[model samples]
Target chain A: MESIRLFCPATVANISCGFDVLGLCLDTIGDEMTITKTAQKGIQITRITGADLPLDVTQNVAGIAAQAFLEQLGTDQGFAIEIHKKIKAGSGIGSSAASAAGAVFGLNALCGNPFTNKELISFAMKGEALASGCEHADNVAPALLGGFTLIRGYEPLDVIALPVPSELYVTVIHPQIALKTAEMRAVLAPEIPLKNAIAQWGNLGGFIAGLYTEDYNLMQRSLSDKIVEPVRSPFIPGFDKIKETALQNGALGAGISGSGPSIFTLNKGIKTAKKVAFAIAENYTETGIPFEVYTSPINKSGVRIINR
Target chain B: MESIRLFCPATVANISCGFDVLGLCLDTIGDEMTITKTAQKGIQITRITGADLPLDVTQNVAGIAAQAFLEQLGTDQGFAIEIHKKIKAGSGIGSSAASAAGAVFGLNALCGNPFTNKELISFAMKGEALASGCEHADNVAPALLGGFTLIRGYEPLDVIALPVPSELYVTVIHPQIALKTAEMRAVLAPEIPLKNAIAQWGNLGGFIAGLYTEDYNLMQRSLSDKIVEPVRSPFIPGFDKIKETALQNGALGAGISGSGPSIFTLNKGIKTAKKVAFAIAENYTETGIPFEVYTSPINKSGVRIINR
Candidate 1:
């Protein structure tokens, strides 16, 4: 294929009780990108629309990730990329991850699929670092491999693709406030109580098990964050009321999505998810902060080809 | 049934990354107990053999568990209990849990099972508190429910039974040394580094995912302890060498069983488990400490009737 148009998914990271390690893909929200082979031997960001982002090869997440992929592949083949963003920057819903994962994914596909989707994560992580100031896989992994992704470890880059329940739906509301990942990370303490840590891991285990069994109630019970949410939620306007309203309106569980200004809830069906979206939207209207609410099914396929 | 004789399986708690929350039951290593309904109006420890333990109802773990069960049942009918112990107390192999769980299990059977195995965990925990100075359900949950268990929360006592791989085997080495759980707990700081906590939960989520999928490689990678093992392993002599030998001999993973003095390794089959057990035994013999090693399959039935 001379050119590939791809749909790169937005992801929800820092899931409740799964902070820093777990994330899932979304079906309805993403960025569209096209990668075309060029005669010149280097990466290029030819165009971007719908968002103000750097176009420099060194500064762009997609450019950085594409550079890392080609460098590893030892290819002189150049690629020109264009991104049409739909997910907002700094929305805590893996905006940069979609671009990064999409670049590597499209490149691998055009390069005769030299790398598996799992193999593409590290290359994507390089771009992720440019955006988050750290080489984190929580967002990039799910955006690459789809479904629920558990970052088992980072040193060797072990990422596991977890099973997704058939009926799981997500409701995400981005309050359009700028919450930098670095700034939000600085608010967390370097140390945590051992008891709370135990509770956190326990709930994580339960949540994973619930996903495999499709037990919504167990998932609800396990979807709690004791360590990170309490400190970061205060920064987001009306975080408490939004979460409480979501739960009351039939969300299986609700919490601050990623580092806040955005909140998410998992529901069993689309009907309840939309209800939760409407209720949360109504509740947040009082805060006088403009926000976007999205209701989507869990995306089984991460990055996909849109057109050829 | 007027009288019942049962086998209460031994359990291994504090499973590597699952510290303070995960555990599994054993098939061969356990205790035998007999409980008989009597005309008397109070619980009694009728006889004890194979281990020196108090026969007093209030002081004995079995008695405390039985009393808890009876009080919850609101029964005035008395029962005579006798325990034939095989698992040594303070072995970090859930010896106390065997007795505690066995008491409630037998009483429930005689009383037509007023409480389920999951429900019996709380009653068994009452007895466990006397042994560990804290009410912990890690061991008792697995011992009562049979197979692997996760203590998701302590406030409302949510214990989840996880799937056990059919080929999974366990090897445990009990170094006959006095290491109290409370003392071992003291060696740990009240707080832990947030980075390590993140690594811990990541591995825990991976391990649970591995169990559900039966991926041995994933299990091996995930069965690691970062927070507790470093500080507590020193208390167990030949800890590093034993773990290395077990891993070298094809054991999936190895770590301290509970608090200290006992170490356990998981293997795919009985042959590998026995090989790992022999390797660990040889490695520990140099310490000149008397130790007993046992290899067994995963117990599916927590406590079962032997005779009635």
Candidate 2:
């Protein structure tokens, strides 16, 4: 196929206890992108809609990701990308990741799948680094591999795709306040108490176990962040109350998604997820902050072909 | 049953990345004890054998655990516990845990099994506190519940029993050096780098996922310690060499077994486990320190009735 239309998923990172290592893809919330094979031997971002991002090949995440993929492939083949962003930038829900992952995913598909979905993560992370100021896989991984993904380490860029329970649903509330990744990171301390770290790892282990066993109660119990949430939550207005509201409305767990400003909740079923979404929206409305709520099942397929 | 004899399996706690929260039971290395119902009004230690230990109920771990269990049961009836210790105290294996878990397990069995194996963890922890100076359930949970166990948290005492792969085996080398838990803990800082904490939790999540999926290679990759091992390894002579030797000998992973002095390696099969045990023994023989090596399958049953 010379041209391919793709749907790239948004992802929620730092799921409670899984700070820099865990993430899950979202269905029904993403960006639409079209990539076409070009005779000119270079990558290009021809157009971007719904968000005012740079069009420069080096500046745009899609362009950066596409460049990374082609450079690694050592191919003279060029591609032009058009991104129709549905997930807003700086919303703390892997907005850049969708664009980055989509570029490589579509390019690999158009190139007769030169790379596996997992292989696309490193290329996507090059773009992610431009957005987050660091090459982290928490968002890009899930956005590429689908479902739950764990960034076990970075030296070798080890990423593992975890099982997704069929009934699991996610409700993300993106408060329209501008929470930059750097500003959110600045609030955190470089060191944490060993005791708190132990608790966090324990909860992380439990949460993974819960996913494998499909135990909702265990997931609820294990969904706690001892180190990051306490310090970062203060930056977001009514963060505690929003989390309490979600929990009260039947969310399995709630915590800061990626960084501050966006709060995500995981629920066992769509009914509870929608209830959590409504409750969080109604509660956060008092703050008079413009916010959009999206509820979707855990996306089983990260990036998919829309049309060709 | 008026009188019951029980065998309580030894356990390996920490398991590298799962510090303070994870453990697994062993099949062959354990302690044997007999508890008998008596007309007396409280718990008693009637006989002691195989090792020097206290006859007084309060001083003995078994007695302390029995007291906690009986007190919680609000029972006026009494029992006599005979100690036949096969597992050495201060061996870094779960010697105290075996006794404690065995006491509660045997008492619960005689008392019509009111408490589940999971419920007995708290009572067993009461005895564990006497040994570790803290109410940590890593060893006790596995000793009572068997297989692999994760102590998710302590506030409400959440203990989760994890699935054990059928081929998993453990090899433990007890270097006969006096290494105190307090000293081992002293080497560690109260705080750790947030980056290392993230790496630890990432490995922990991966390790749990590996356990559930029976992925040995994943388990091998995830069995790493970043925070505790660096500071504590120096206390154990030839730790690095021993670990390298284990890895070189095809062991899946190796680390300090609860605290120090005892080194443990996990292997995919009994053959590899025994091979690891023999290699560790030969390597440590050069240290001129007397050592004992035990290789066993992963014990699925924690404490079992040997006779009634």
Candidate 3:
């Protein structure tokens, strides 16, 4: 087949205790892209929908990802992708990564699936790096591989797809306000206290154990952010109150999702997820700020071919 | 049931990436202690063996642990303990922790296990605090509860016992050279760079995931000390060469066992564990330095009563 259509779901990264290292994909809210072969001997962005992002082939996330992957393939065969995004940009929900990972994933299928998942992630990171001046696999890894993920290291690029508890439900509340990723990262201290670093690693270990063993209480206890959120929460308004309400309303634990403006609560069931969404919505709805909430079980299959 | 005979196993704290928050118990080496109910109305250190540890109830690790426990229990019943140490002190193999944890484990069992594991760890920390000028539960928690463990938080004393892979093996080599724990800790920097801390946490998350999923390659990849070992490894003689030899000779990964001098390597089977031990031992024996080696599977049952 010379053409493929795919859906790459949104991702929630930096899961509180696991800043920049852990992430989970969502079942809803994604970017759909169609990759088609063209007579032209180069990769290009044919169309972009739902938001006014860059349209130039060299400047777009999808275009960059496609160009990188096709270069790796060493092929003169031409390809063009049309993207329809449902996830909002700069929402701390890996919206940009959805476009990047989706293009690579869809293009790989059109090229007969020559590359591995890790390679696809490598190609996809070019898009994120071009946009943010850094390469982060936390969002794109899960968005491509699905489920819970741990980007173990970067020197050799270790990425592992971790097990996700079947009962886990995610509720993401995205406030309309945009928090630039660069500015969100700039708020963090360059050096962390040794004690705090130790605590963070401990929580990360326990959190991973909870995911594999399906220990809900352990996961809740391990959901603390002793490092990242404390430093960056000031950028997101009403962060503490929404988190407290989410935790009090039967949600297991809550924290700022990804970077800022989007807060997420984890729960044991969909009902609790909906309850948390309403409770968190109560904090933002009356303030005349436009917001979006998405509830989903942990996404088991990340980027998939929704249409052939 | 006036007296009890129990053994507390040696432990390897700082499990590479975990720093002060992760550890595991070893089956081969330990401190054997017999705790007896006495007619006297106080805790006492009656007999000590192997190393010249302080015997005073206030200054001794075992005595401090027992005193703290009896005080918290608030009972008029008195207790006396006799310790026979097989693990070497100042060797980076948790010899002191064996005494401290053994005292609490034996006394609690003699008292019909009144306190929970967390309480036992709390009681045990007093012993370490009195000896080291700080309270650390990495070694004691795993020694008391067995298997791999994560001390997620310290303010409220949160400890979680993690699962160990059935096929995992530990090889510990203790060189006769003495490097005090205080000196070892002194070598470490007070603060860690944010990038290094991120890498450490990432490895820790992957390590825990590998444990639960029984992924050996991931565990081997994750067994990296991005924080402590890099700073403290200089204190241990032939550290790099020995670790390189072990890794080359079928060991999964190798690092300083606890603080200094002693080096531990993890592998899949007893044969490889033996091979790695010999390979590492070759590095020390040729230098005319006295060293002891112990190999065992991951201890599932930590402190246990031999003759109940």
Runs with alpha carbons beyond 4 Å of true place in candidate 2: none
Worst 10 residues of 1 chain B by lDDT: B278-287
Q: List the global CA lDDT of all models.
A: 0.93, 0.92, 0.87
DockQ of 3: 0.86
Q: Where is model 3 chain A poorest over a 10-residue stretch in terms of lDDT?
A: A280-289
Chain A vs. true chain A, TM-score per candidate?
0.99, 0.98, 0.98
Model 1, range B1-308, lDDT digits (tens) per residue? 39999999989998899999999999999999999999998799989988899999999999999999988889988899999999998899999999999999999999898888899999999999999889999999999999999999998999988999988999999999999899999999999999999999999999999999999999999999989999999998889999999999999999999896889999999999999999888888888999999999999879999999
Highest-lDDT candidate: 1
DockQ-derived CAPRI band for the predicted complex in model 1: high
Query: How does candidate 1 fare on TM-score?
Result: 0.99
Put down candidate 3 lDDT per residue, A197-287, tens digits, no spaces.
8888888888887887788998998899888898788887777888888988999888888987799889999899999888888877776
All candidates' TM-scores? Answer: 0.99, 0.99, 0.97
lDDT of 3 by residue, B147-238 (tens): 99899888778888888998899998888897878887888887889999999999988888888778999999999987888888887778
| Candidate 1: residue pairs that collide | none
